[model samples]
Target chain A: MEQLVSALLIMIIGVLACAAYFYASNWLLDVLFPSKNKPADIVAKNIHITNTVRPWLFIGPALIALTFYLIYPVIESIRLSFLGRAGEEFVGFDNYAWLFSSDTFYQSFKNNMLWLIVVPTASTFFGLIIATMTDKIWWGNIAKSLIFMPMAISFIGASVIWKFIYDFRSGDDAQIGLLNAIVVFFGGEPQAWITVPFWNNLFLMIILIWIQTGFAMVILSAALRGIPSETIEAAVLDGANSIQIFFKIMVPQIWGTIAVVWTTITILVLKVFDIVLAMTNGQWGTQVLANEMFDWMFRGGGDFGRGAVVAIVIMVLVIPIMVWNIKDVNKEMEGR
Target chain B: MMAVSSSRSSLMWVVHITVFILVVMWTVPTAGLFISSIRDKDQLSVSGWWTALSVSEQRLVARSEHPDKQVFSSDGRYEIRGNILEHQDSSITKFGSSSLRPDEFDVGVVAQLKGGKTLQVLENGDYIYSSPEQWKGKRGKRIFYTANIPPRFTLDNYREVLTSEGLAKSFINSLAVTIPATIIPILMAAFAAYALAWMKFPGRALIIAAVVGLLVVPLQMSLIPLLKTYNLIGEFFGVGSKGYIGIWLAHTGFGLPLAIYLLRNYIAGLPGEIIESARVDGANDFEIFSKIILPLSFPALASFAIFQFLWVWNDLLIAMVFLGNNEEQLVLTGRLRELLGSRGGNWEILTASAFVTIIIPLCVFFGLQRYLVRGLLSGSVK
Candidate 1:
């Protein structure tokens, strides 16, 4: 209880301190360059100076934080990739060589490729189908919300939920888990789902796909709504079936939005570490780049060199999407 | 949508059925966890949650009364009588004296024992043992029965996890991390968003573009360098590297780009005349912001708050990296992961703990999901 109270106190103080800084700093800026009740020329000069300075005042703290946390880290990580474990000595390309030569790194890379191919495509496909079907139904909102509920659950929580489903009991213990129960009900042997080598990767991917389908659905549902009714109406009048109208007219129009949802889930799949970490911790041939990176970060009192190399690999994969996102935003901003 | 053909109506049935199956598929996992959390711990391991509603059959062993409790009947025969079931709600279906065939005799049947002793068991669990001579055994006879136990539910798992599993502490820690992390980013991002939107400053376009790029940078890229920076700062300041303040700042830094982007999109879409009129009325940027822009952008701010709150609350990687794993600082997700590692097979503990960690977000998601969806629609760059 005392700890809670102290935490509450700290929270209030922290927030209030940020508020105070913004207010006080802006107030100081106004005080330092007073434009009121001054000579007209001096007032104009003060207005110009404050116009330039006050925006900075509003933006200063955010800029400093973004630079320190994000921009500088990107550069420092790239530099550390070329350095030694403690990051004090330079080891040019040694970490990269080791990363390529290691069996575990190869396994992680292959698994990551599998995840990249499976998670996004499956999620996007299910999302599109569910979105289209649900829009035609009356209870669509309830279905959408239920599907979207998994998005709110943490990866660890979802792992636990799915783990309970995949739980195994040996030697005719009535098969408590739902999966094994069903398997035994159908006269099949119960297998340890997460321990299988190649197939277990698909099992793990199912959890992610289940969690992400809702996100894709929501976004794609919105995009489906954005489709012009006239086009669909025309398609229907042209003797087109529902499927034809959907694929031929509606989906093509929302291709951009579909791409957006696809890329978003793709980015998420790349950064997915918690599910694997909590579920298997890269065991059973289920390693991925992000989890492997996390492993190296703390494996032997912190191997900063190899960890940064893995991070750079993730960055390289993300660069195309990053470039595309910026260009899309720039194009949209210009239209605005 | 209104002009569907009659043939499509049959297809609509297919759609409804398919959607029903999909909804059940999505909802049953969570529903199972919720039901399991409230079930009797003994029944939970033996039956699936789908069967939680019906009576569960169990093989239970009970002991008959000892010979000291025997009474002399009117005919001078010794008899012992007692109820086997502790709870009257359960009914015994079959009984036996050995473990090999626990259901050797049907209820209400009399089974003859050695030495002219006969035992009769009833469905309601009442049993009678009769002997012609005086009963001499000190110990009671062991009787096994296949009993139909009623469905039972309790909140004991929740109580145990909350009180003893350290979830109660982690709940508070999650709040302490989430609330400030949620609020601080809103304040900082609202100001920055306002600047990027209304104020015509140099390089504003570049900054906006940069924010978009940063949106996709994998957090793995930042972990090592940030930890190094934290360690250095901690060395200089004589504090632990992993602390709440450090994590709060970290969440804020990560969340700011989205916050700014979402708010900027909304704020820029607001009627520009309001800010212009306020400016013409001799109001400064600060005045126009606090009184006008802030109130008008409440939906965006709220949506971002919900996002940041859920993100910080549900985050495990950040919590594991940025905060200590001790009871003082472990968030719910971290604690749940630890529990998953240690008590991997204990379903009651895992289910209860996982439900506790997810319950708040589920509530918030259900309550403010409209704003969340709206935020996502606008937050994603078209």
Candidate 2:
């Protein structure tokens, strides 16, 4: 009861404090830097809206929001990573050392690697196929929309709809779980589909694929449609068959788009939590780093240190990809 | 022939057929959900909805007082003069009324009983009974009638689902989280993106790189740590640790880097001419962004909003972390997830909940979808 009350108290006070801080910062800015540009244009010279100050003003609320929610947590996680389960006592590099020495963490890291490789590739591949095939059809837009419909469903929702598909019921009076019913019809034993470990990950991957294929298709479709018609015609005149044209002309032309599609799916795969939570809850060797963190923190009686280490590791893995993506964008820009 | 002007014109039919097949393939599961939501629960159990339009033979149990009890008499025996044609008045359809004489009747005729009783039945549940004696005994026995019911449709399923299902509350919860989650990120991202795109500063590249670097940092990686941070700060400031504001901030933080990246790319790609001209006209960055860049970059804004809206609306993890699981605070996604375990087989509730969750997204998507143009990149690329 005291905990709940104190938490509430903290929320109200934190908000008020943050507000006060912002106001104080603004005042400090006013006192610290007086503009020397009285001769400036009306738009630029507005004392309240200088180009230098305005951007920060625009950026201020967002920065505070991120700081409390994201940046602070990232810092705190690093601090907590070395702490024990009590969270009061500090243990230096123990969590980091545990990660290198621990088999469980290693296995989880391996599984995540497999998921990252498999999910993005499959989604992107299917997306490319759908995009290319539909691009030629007259009702392409409608077809694309149908495939994209699953994208509207939350990950949890998709997991549910897929659950019925993968459902296994013990041989009951009717074998009502759909997939098991089919297996029964074929005179096979019903299996607990989600408990099947690596195979279950594939099942989870299907849900991601179902939702994301449309995203991949849509972006790639837009890029496909954007290809200059004359370029394709010219390729055809040069004795390229349909397959050759697709491979040589189309693929090369849309490389930037393909890269974008791949990267976006990669980003989504990194944060995948809902499907795992909804379906397997990261049990039976299907645990990814993200869901594992939740297990350690919330489910496993709040192991903040290990959870933080996993988070830091994820950040390390993802930051480089983000940098690579940025570099790719810069290159795409420079190439253009 | 004009048709021969196209060598494979005949194959156009083939192409159309193939495309139609694919469309049907894509549409079947969705169609199944729609049909399952409305179909009678009993019928839904016995057969798939593809048979919804066909007459279904259903065994309807009814009261069958002895036919003699169904009749009324004016005179005693020898009242067989009137057959099933003129007696009681109620219409009965393709199903014969009696189990013993299941096939004893024809299209529109009734039959006479041995005890000078007459019964008439029509195809529409109208029936008449006449007998030489007064009726006696309670409803005789339970009668089974195999009635061929024509296809029936009702809004009752939806009514039951939306009202009693608790989906309505969850739908609102989802929106509460979603609306703020959607708004805060775009608001932040737009400003950050503009700064990154237009504002000159030291370490601009580094800041963007940091943000981009932040992009891959999975929220799961930071989930526990973030919660701890919130708790600590909440402690100092008297805030407990979790709430809507916390979730919104989390969503905004998670959403910010991408929003910044996407919007910056788009804003940066804007014809430099416009920003340059605005600058020359002495317009500051905000005015130029608000007046010139925003309107021109509608496609980007719409796309990003769609992505962010759908994402936050569908988010479960952040909601689980920052927001308490209390009924009032539980978002739609979380609620739907809970329902998946408890009410998994209740197709009506599941479909209705899904539709409720998706309603806003569909609205947002179709609404802004038009702004997703073909060639926003054309001017930028060239």
Candidate 3:
């Protein structure tokens, strides 16, 4: 009975909210985006004052959220990095020295390098190949949907699925792990997959590749579709073969789209944590900068100082790429 | 007659073939998973799901009734009858004791039973006992019969995983995270996007740049710092950091930059003339945004919402960092991860949970699928 009443009340609130939004939106449109008729000077003065206040109402939440969430934490991180757990004892360079001098930090840095180098490139390359192939075809939409399915899956979700594929177990007499099962069927010895230090990283890389390849495919495919048919025809008529036309004409035309996909995946690769966490939990040298930072801050034996340094280092790498991405996007906008 | 067109067409076919292969390669594992998830657990454990169409061979023992249950009749016949399934080798038609001798036994075999009674069994479970005359004892001894049970399909796995496994609860928790996370950003991004898109303001460029800067700063970097800020702020407000609000705010923080970026581009692509005319007609910025910008920018709003919704819904790290690991507070992705580690062998639960997790994202994606394909910047381009 109580549940029924609350349901009723909730519905009433929802209806009321919608009605208010509707009426307010109508009034708002009438005021802010009135018909193109020129207004009187007196009315214009009021409109200008309201307009000044209006943008704040529009953007105010973002500012508040950003200040508290992004900006404040950033400042606090810097400060906390200089302090100990109590956040009172100031140990300025100790955090920096500890992170830099430690083997864990070096390993994390190396993993980050591998991630930065491999994920984006592999993803983009596969995306381009698929894009070029799937530009216009009978089954193109279906094909695209298949590839793009992983993007719908979350990072954690992808990690879980991949774990089964990479499921490793000890002892031959025990249950056959998935990967080992396949290998042994082919008359190969059961390898301790994750225990193989260097190759295990590649095994880890496959998950990211599986996920990002779809994203790259979609964006790059769109770009490929956007390329003008006339340009391709002209290139072919000018004595170019398929490969040459692809490399020369198609590449130049779709560079903008390629840039968009490359940067997007690059940004994603830098923040990667779940795959490593889910698969190996950063054990056996799979830990990257983000996971390491997480380790430093959240775990029981956490170091505030080291966590902050890693955070700052990640920021340093990302900001420049982002700036470049924005500039490219803005330039593309201006060119249009 | 059409050599040039024919060759060109062939080239297109070549491209089509290549694309088709890539798509098939991509979908194989998911298909395998889908097949494995639905099959019987016993079958799933033993063989790859790809073999679901084929019949499976299993072995079991058919045992005769116990010696104590048999009795001699007046006509010199012994009788023993009961559920034969309990017997170790009751009514054996063909019997190979061990898996190493899988092919040794043949059908319609005669084996000598205790007390010199001869029992003949057919390939089927039908057993014939030759006795002297009238049967004595209550019933025949229990015999075990073995048959190749054909492949069985069921929804029981889904039921078990969804109800007993707490998947329904996790599904709800996922929605709780996703809906708010999606809505908050879209609502905020709509306003911010309109302002950046149309409304001229001081420090707009800087904020937009800052947003772009935030985009690149790797969420891993901010996750810790952000958690610290939340704990401190929570202490002041006396609100626990381990609640829905903290994680929502965290997701909101993470989702904002991309939301703002995607949305601003879309809103900016709307007809400037309409906005300008509205401004000239004495309308305020908020009014213009709420009515014109929001409606026209729906497609972009939708696309960005899908992206944000999916990201937050699927998010495990931020949820782990902010939301407590307790079952009630745990997000679907986090719960799924925990389940994967603990019940890695349970394909049914895993797939059903996976399907449930995807339901929202898929709905959001398909609901706004058109926008997903749209490059809102096409307007700016034109």
Which candidate leads in TM-score? 1
For each candidate in turn, the TM-score is: 0.94, 0.77, 0.84
**What is the DockQ score, from 0 to 1, of model 3?**
0.41
Clashes of each: 0, 18, 27
- Candidate 3 deviant stretches above 4 angstroms: A1-48, A168-182, A326-336, B1-16, B59-104, B107-147, B375-382
Q: Where does model 2 exceed 4 Å of error?
A: A1-52, A92-111, A167-198, A226-231, A283-286, A329-336, B1-21, B55-152, B237-240, B271-296, B372-382
Better of 1 and 3 by lDDT: 1
Q: Compared with the true structure, what per-residue lDDT tens digits does model 2 show for residues A227-297?
A: 99999999867967667888888989989778777776787787787888888777887888777777777
Question: What class would a CAPRI assessor give candidate 3's docking?
Answer: acceptable
True contacts kept of each: 0.79, 0.46, 0.48
Ranking by DockQ: 1, 3, 2
Highest DockQ against the true fold, candidate = 1
Task: Tell me which residue pairs clash in candidate 1.
Answer: none
lDDT of 2 by residue, B272-373 (tens): 887888888866565676678778877777777777778898888888888887766777888878877788667657755665666676676655554432
Chain B superposition TM-score per model: 0.89, 0.74, 0.81
DockQ versus reference, model 1: 0.80
DockQ for every prediction shown: 0.80, 0.32, 0.41
- Candidate 3: chain B TM-score against the reference chain B: 0.81
Model 1, residue A118: what's the lDDT? 99
Chain A TM-score by candidate, in order: 0.98, 0.81, 0.84
